[model samples]
Target: MNNVKSLNKWANAHTYLPVDLLRMALGVFLFMKGVYFFSNIQYLVDLLTPIDKIDRIGAGMFLIHYIAPAHLIGGILIFFGLLTRWAIISQLPILICAIIINFMGQMHHQNLLLAILTLAVCIFFLIYGSGKNSADYFFKMQK
Candidate 1:
């Protein structure tokens, strides 16, 4: 009876969180795409049409060029469970911009869907702010 009770308690304490999964998924997605972006500079440069028209090509390059860092840096932060909340917060705008760009010029349903899903994951990360097992455990601010 005691063992059964303990098993039940352990299960209750270890329920899987959808949000943590979302964060990890986003991290993986970003990391993979970042590698692709860095490998093919021209491809990313073409995507900067919106920013280019506004006389911000340099700025655009700086932002887009750093997508890999988001994946690399953000992934590390999230993976190590350190400063995850801030990392997610930092990534939100980048995901939003990608979504907006995908919607702005050509109405490619696939691109739109991808952007939307990415944005949704960003939102999920914000809400969950990393789970207990994450390195976020150390820097967790008291609310």
Candidate 2:
């Protein structure tokens, strides 16, 4: 089908070396962060407490329960360059919410910085996709 060809073409699109490296680095960082969250779930919940207060009841709870897993999965997919664009798309909302929540009240500079960086990288991936060096390209080649 033409749609399949179009998809393959998109997936095989060339990317600058620097951009690919940046994407890989961001994926690694996010994957590590997800692992850290799993190990320190209570700590993550504690950090979200302030955001819940700023927003509504159970908002922080919802983010931790739902978004955390998505973050972890998205990180894995992005890291492997499997469905990278969709993975980034899924993470965009979480990153935006993180920025907003972390930016409010007595801000932690480090958290804000991390959130901003993640958001920037997510945006980049959303626009540019995985690139020629990715598993996406390999899969497309097989098709």
Q: 27-62, model 2: which lDDT tens digit per residue?
A: 888778888888889977767666546346656666
How many backbone collisions does model 2 have? Answer: 0
List per-candidate RMSD values in Å: 8.0, 3.2
Runs with alpha carbons beyond 4 Å of true place in candidate 2: 1-13, 53-59
lDDT of 1 by residue, 1-143 (tens): 67634543453355366645656666777777778878887887777565546444357657765666786677667655567667777777777877778766666688678878877776655555566556554444343
lDDT of 1 at 140: 41
Consecutive 10-residue window with the lowest summed lDDT within model 1: 4-13
lDDT of 2: 0.76
Best by lDDT: 2
